[model samples]
Structures are given as C-alpha cells and as structure tokens.
Target: MTELALLVQGLLDGSIYALIAVGLTLVYGLLRILHVAHAALFTLGGYVGVVVTNETGSFILALVAAMIVAGIAGMIIYRLVYQPILHLPPYVALIASIGLFIAMQEGFRFYDEQGVSYVNPPVQGTLELAGQTLQLAKIVTFFVAIILIGGLGLLAAKTRTGVAWRATVTMPAMAESFGINIIQVRYINFFIGSALAAVAGVMVSLTTNLVEPTSGDVWSYKALAIIVLGGLGSMRGTLIACFALGVLEAFATTTCVPLGNIQICLGEIMNRDAIAFAFLVIVLMIRPQGLFVRA
Candidate 1:
C-alpha cells in the first residue's frame, strides 16, 4: 500500500512536471532557442491567477486571464526580443533570455517583494484513492494536464495549424515558399507554449497556495534539465523523462535503505533538485544523445 501510494503520488507530480516542461520542449523544437524567460512567464501566470482570483473570486476566470496575458507576452517577447537576435549566434539569444528572466524576476519582486497567497482556493479537502489520501487539487491537476497535453497532441496530429507548424519546423524556407505564414506560425508557437506554461503555473500556485517572485527560479533550470535529459526538443521524450524524474525523486525522498548498521535515506543525502540533475548526469553518461534522440 505504501509503495502504491508513492507511485500514485509520483505520477501526479509527473503530470505537473510534464505541464511545465512541455512548453519548454515546444519552444526549443520550434525556435531552437532556450527560452529561460519561459520561467518568467510561468511566474507571471501565477501572479495573474492569484490577483484575478482574489479580486473576482473566479478561479476559471483567473485561468483564462493568465493564459491570455501570458500568450500575448510570449508573442511580444518573440517579436521584440528573440526575432531581432535570432540571426545572431544561438548563445546570444540564450544570454538575452537569461537576462530577460532575471529582469522579470526583479520586476515581480518590485511589484510585490513579499509575495502573495491565494485568498480562497477553489479546491479544498482530500480524497481517498486506493487506500491512499490525496489532495483534491493534485488530482485535478493530473486530469487537467492529461486533457491539455492530449488536446495539444490532437492539435498537432489533426489540425491544419499543426500541419503548418510541422512544416515550419521541418523547413521554414520551404514552408514560406509554399505560402505558409512563417511569422504567424512563430507567433502561434510562442503563444501556445506560453499559454501552456501559464496554466501550469496557475495549477502549481493553486496546489501550493502561494505565489512568490522567485517561484519560477527553480523550474527555469530544472525544465531545461528535463528537456535535455529527454532529448532536446523531443515532445515524447520530454513526457517520458518528466515522469521518470518525478518517480525517481518520489522514491528517493520516500524510500530508505539499510546498509551496514546505518540507514541511508536518499532524501537526506541529496535534495530533490539535486536528485533530478544527478539522474540526468547518469542518463547522459549512458546515453549522451538523450533518452529518445535517434543516434
């Protein structure tokens, strides 16, 4: 029962990780740039959600507002920041992204240095599932991730927009030559990716019940690690790697081993974030191309 509970918890956490990392994967796949500022957008979403919820007492509205705000911010960032520097070396864009992330963090701090908490979370209480207690919000988060990610998959596989996106990714020049609006595609990519990140942000803030200026700091790097470990820009690989990391971290934190008269607790030895990076290192050593990248 304990093991089962851990597994369930791990899967729930993995869903959240997928929500956060999928946007990063999409942006990287389409733009070939590490959008460190994507973290800022995540933080921005949380703030928007909190403020909107508090002011209007509507969680659904908060979600919608966050998505709209973040989506527009993403398109603006792409046009004003990334588009101008994309002709330069990739590192240049990376540095700029890092700078933008830091600036946004500072901006958040300036807006409210102390951070904020939800006035009234929409979901409260726990649920009994398979003899294990679980937060209702987490369960909701899991289903929400499923629906959104699955919807994204369908969009990519079935929609004309998806076809255009794939064409742009495969051959931007040819896509443009064929009358596909490359600029529109890029804007749509950023908008969707940023919107997804925003939704993830709202879900996370709701679960935690707090929104801090530095909430996005950890994810900025961690999401990068997830994407790289999953094979950079591989959507399927990213999903697999997110779940794998979530389960590994869950086990590391919850399980202890007896060794030579001394019990070793993995969580005590290393923090959760450290465990994630360590796993990434071990995986890279074994398969440097990443878990799913074709050799």
Candidate 2:
C-alpha cells in the first residue's frame, strides 16, 4: 500500500514536471535557444496567481490571468531580447537569456519580499484510487495537464500556425520561400510554451500549497534536466522521461530498502534534486540522446 501510494504521488508530481518540460522542449525545438529566463516566467506565474487569488478569492480567475500575463511576457521577451539576436550565434542568445533570468529572479525577490507564499485550491476532498487516497488538487492538476497537452497536440497537427511552425523548424529557408512567416510562428510557439509553464506554476503551488521566490529557479533546473533526459526536441520522450523521473524520485524519497536486517533510507542518502541529476548522468552516459530519443 505504501508503495502504491508512493507511485501515485510520484506520477502526479511527474505530471507537473512534464507540463513544465513540454514548454521548455517546445521552445528549444522552435528556436534552439536555451531560454534560461523561462524559469522566471514560472515564478512570475505563481506570484501573479497568488496575488490574484488573494485579492479576488477566485482560483480559476487567478489561473487564467496568470497564464495570460506570462504568455504576454514571453512574447515581449522574444521580441525585445531574442528577436534582435535571432540571427546571432546560439551562445549569444543563451547568454542573454541567463541575464534575463537573473534580472527576473531579482524582480520577483523585490516584489514578493514578504514571507513564503501559497495558494489554496478551490475545491477540497480526496479520491480513493486502488485503496490509496488522492488529493483533489492533484487530480485536478493531472486532468488539466492531460487536457492542455492533448489540445496543444491537436493544434500542432491541424492548425495553420502549427503546420507553419513544423515547416519552419524543419526547413526555415523552404518555409520562408513558401511565404510562411517564421517570426509569427516563433511568437506563437513561445507564447504557448510560456503559458503552459505558467499553468504548471499555478498547479504546483496548489499541490504543495506553498510558493517561494526561488521556486522558479528550483523547478527550472529540474525542468531542464527533464527535457534533456526525455530528448531535446521530442515531446513524447519528454513526457515519458518526466513521469519516469518523477516516479524514481518518489521511490527514492519514500521507499526504504532492507539490507541484512538493516533499513536503508535512500531519500536520506540523496535528495530529490540529487537523485534527478544522478539519473541524468547515467542516462546521458548510457543513452546520450535521452530515454525516448532514437538515433
């Protein structure tokens, strides 16, 4: 029962990671930029959502507003910072993003100088699954992730913007020859990715019921690891890796192994972040392309 509960919790956590990683992977696929500042967008979402919830006492409103704000911010960043460097070397953009990340982190620190922040879920209760109880907030988050991902997947497949994005990434010259506006595609993709990250921020805050200014920095690194482990540009790989890592972290944190009449607490030996990177190293060595990437 304990193992089952741990697995469930791990998968739920993984879902959030997957949500965050999807955005990171998508942006990478579109522009090949690391977009380190993406983390700040996540933190911004949480801060905005918390403030909105506090002022209006409406979780749904807060969620929508946060996403909109973050999405717009993402577009603005791309236009002001990335667009100017679009033709420059990738490393140049990477450096710019790093600077942007630090600036946004400090901005959050200045604004949210209060103590820790948290958001309350709109509904309460738990669902029993396979004799294990699941928090309503987690369930909502899981469903929301599935719905958003699915919708995005469909949009990518069917919409003109989606088709243009794929074509532009596949062959920028050919896409441009066909009159596809790569700039517009980039803007749309960045907006979608950033908005998704915002949703992840809000969901994560609801699940943990806590938020700090550093939350973005923490999850941003983990999200980067997730995308790398899942394969840089493969959405399917990212999802698979995200849950696998999540479950692995859960097991590490919760499962105690017996060894010759003694118990070993894996979680104590290495924290979740450490466990994630350990898996990352092994995966990189064994399968440099990632768990889901096939060469």
Q: Ten consecutive residues with minimal summed lDDT in candidate 1?
A: 215-224
lDDT of 2: 0.85
Model 1, 55-97: lDDT tens digits are 9999999999999999999999999999998889999999999
Which lDDT values do the candidates have, in the order given? 0.89, 0.85
lDDT tens readout by residue for model 2, 1-295: 5778878888898888877888888888878888889998888888788788888998899999999999999999999998899889999999999999998888876776652454444556789987888888887888899999999999889998889888887788899999998888888888888898999888777756666777887788988998899888888888998899889998887778999999998888998898889999988999888887622
Clashes of 1: 0
Q: What is the TM-score of each candidate against the true structure?
A: 0.96, 0.92
Candidate 2 Cα deviation (angstroms), residue 219: 1.6
Model number with the top lDDT:
1
List the pairs of residues colliding in candidate 2: none
Stretches of model 2 off by over 4 angstroms after superposition = 115-121, 128-133, 258-263
Scored against the true structure, residue 10 in model 1 reaches a CA lDDT of 87
